[model samples]
Target: MPLHKVIYLSNNAKLYLWKITEDFDALFNQIRLKDSSLARLQTMKSENHKKGFLAVRMLLQHNDYNDFDLYYDAFGKPHIKPQGCSIKDVEISISHSNDFSAIVISEQKVGLDVEQIKEKALKIASRFMDVSHLENLSKEEQIKKATVVWGIKESIFKIKNEKGISFPNHIFEDDFNFEDKKATATLKFNNKEEKFKIQFDSEEDYIFVCAFESIKN
Candidate 1:
């Protein structure tokens, strides 16, 4: 198991990235899975998704947890049951892109998304992002920026995990320069609004974005 990188986002939040170098059997043999998780893994249509799923369990194990401590809700959001002796609650988000799988664990409300850089993201930018933000930049820069913006929207959605949150209509990302590597977004849904603090960075050919609900909310 090659643990690619570990990022400490804040005092209570940390992110882990795993480069999927093991074969399916290798990964499968290493982690313990619950019955429901085993059934769910069997339904995954692609080996990449299975590898990503198993790799996430590897990450959980690295953090002293296993599949038994994890669960999902009706919305398909992942959660962790803290050890009985521990005082802090745990929040987690998971994402995978190509040969990489990543997870973010936090004591605060958090969301995370990782995306591979692709021209398609630029082509569909108008559907989910403010196109003007990509203006005056080179084509490659536009793709990177557009992908980051998409990731920003996804991260915010994961944090809120509420119904009727459309990426284009409900999530609004503030203007940001690519060099900053971080930004903020507002999720306006239902009849109220909340703000999120966002941080993003690139690794290899992928963009990783993490969101934390603003304390001011």
Candidate 2:
């Protein structure tokens, strides 16, 4: 399976998804990794996690970039070296959960998250979201909606990539209709408030969310 799916988050941003159907060795053999990537891969305790890491590299290569071109900052945020004399530095965000790994590359700052839909996200809904939003949905809908909210907050946090941002305390998602397949959130921290635009979709029981910092914020 080359790519599970691709979404154009915007004119300048494209999101890539890889379903981890291949085993670790199958994925590992298809891509090249720098020494640091290899070291980081070795430190992962879970095979699924290792595969996720490898799959991210695969996606990078798919875009003509390799592991050598990727690096991380002190906050563990992933970055891509500006190639040539491009005016805007290319931005990237990576996330994986269970069986899928995802990456989004953009000229604009972007954040991405892929989540496996399960009972756990719903069970902890109260800890991070306004549970009242779940009141009218069926049990199944509740689970999916809760997962989306969590993903929204996660993606926004990735975009901000700063310290002391609390999901429950700082990130707030406005009420949105499921039919809309879109949402907006507000981040209020450090006495500063910012807004973000979010888009999400479900694929094969997994939810993928993308966050872009609002230009006005």
Candidate 3:
């Protein structure tokens, strides 16, 4: 319904996930219509657009039902500004699947992604799975292992604000026991090494996994 989960990674970095169950028409009415035709075309994409608009309403605390003036950068990232809010240096990422739309906000540049793990071809895992890492797991453990690895790579891409990074090569996972419900990923980017902690939880029939950059000294 509201603030399903709040993850605090550091003093300045955190994430907020909200579950939307409101009617699409009410959600659409909350968005301000722009004169530009392109803006109108964008809104027609799906009901998710309306949900995203409503989800953001809680963030700005606006009640007039006016659409907040928001835009994305050349790289397709959402940007927001509050009239009287003093907090700057905040970054956010929004994702929606099924009946849930999540918004992750942080003071540092951050990326957040949630995937519903599905059955896929095993060969696809080779693209992202490290040879050494795969050798250690048996046939059944491979799927869960690969899913966690893929999530780590995706989160890193969001953190780096770029794509085209090889999963298994650029991102590697250390010895982890998924049975413990927590794992860690070691990633190399820009010639620097960073570590990300991955946490997995079961929501209904879905496995929700998230990765966040560890606080640096």
Best by lDDT: 1
Error of 2 at 56 (Å): 0.4
Most accurate candidate by TM-score: 1
RMSD (CA, Å), candidate 2 to true, equals: 1.2
What is the overall TM-score of model 1 with all chains considered together?
A: 0.97
Each model's TM-score, in the order given? Answer: 0.97, 0.96, 0.70
lDDT of 3: 0.60
Candidate 1, residues 1-217, lDDT tens digits: the string is 6788999899999999999999999999999999999999999999999999999999999989999999999999999989779878999999998788999999998999999999999999999988999989999999999999999999998877887889999999999998998898898889789888999988999999999999972
Which lDDT tens digits does candidate 2 get at residues 59-87?
Answer: 99898889999999999999998776766
Between 2 and 3, whose lDDT is larger?
Answer: 2
Model 2 TM-score, all chains together: 0.96
Model 1: pairs clashing at backbone N, Cα or C within 3 Å: none
Runs in model 3 deviating more than 4 A are: 1-3, 7-12, 31-70, 82-87, 121-123, 131-144, 179-181
